[model samples]
Target: MDLDFYKKQALQKQKEHKKFLDGLKKKPPKNLDYQVLETHEETFEEIDCLSCANCCKTTGPLYIEKDIERISKHLRMRQADFEAKFLRVDEDNDKVLQDLPCFFLNDDNTCSIYDVRPKACREYPHTDRKKIYQINNLTIKNTLICPATYVFVEKLRKALEK
Candidate 1:
């Protein structure tokens, strides 16, 4: 995937997407969640996340207590030690990775701790969750970072229109 091209396209459509998403939030279709999940599934069929790990490369996942414990155990490290080594408190007071390109991201764009990755990482872009309309702002922001998100939103818009 040509990330630069997708990023440019997403940037250009930012305002339009935000507007559309806001409208979606106001009064989502009854089956909006279903459509979002369906769209998400189809979008991923064509776009491999390994080909574009911009989300991992550019953004850090919020590490909740359970995630910290799970990942720390998976790596055979003390939770406090793992936190001290790899995480920091963000402005939102959430524990997030200390650096970009995520400390656990291998050279091939695969997560080193794939099985025990953070909940936020497991739900990156978050387009397929229940109550999809509640997270319009996040979905809009993700369009800029994940090409699959961009495609999903565009496809969702079309699906909603008809």
Candidate 2:
């Protein structure tokens, strides 16, 4: 799919989905079935991620202390040097890169340091996992960054309704 088309679709879906979620919050579902349905719907409609690594290109992952150490060590650099050069702690106290389109992301849209990338980077979409309910907030965030989240939620909602 075209990147621009998917980007537009994702943005439109996000707005609609947010409204749906807001409504659900006002009058929460009585059972897990409803939540599952909503998720399925969102999932089924999402765009493919490989075609557009917008998340990697437009945002940085939160790097924990261990990730920072591991990645820095892999780069043959001191932990402090790595932090000074590439990362900073966000207001939420999570270490994140200072800029988007991550420094580790290569021109081909692949992670240059995939083996030692941050935990959050490794778990980008967080939609393919079995335990969907455990990370609703994370899923919501992924909705903005990943088209896969949109597709995953759409599929989940359909399954629930079935």
- Global lDDT scores for all candidate models: 0.90, 0.70
Question: Which model scores highest in TM-score?
Answer: 1
Instruction: Provide the lowest-lDDT 10-residue window in model 2.
Output: 40-49
Candidate 2 per-residue C-alpha lDDT over 27-87 given as tens digits, one digit per residue, 9 for 90 to 100? 5456655455556445545554456788888888888989988999999999999999998
Task: Give lDDT tens digits, candidate 1, residues 39-134.
Answer: 999999989999989999999989999999999999999999999999999899989998998988999999899998999999888978988778
**What count of clashes does model 2 give?**
23
Say which candidate scores most in lDDT. Answer: 1
What TM-score would every model get versus the actual structure?
0.95, 0.73
Give each prediction's root-mean-square deviation over alpha carbons.
1.1, 4.4
Model 2 Cα shift for residue 67 (angstroms): 0.4
Report the Cα lDDT for candidate 1: 0.90
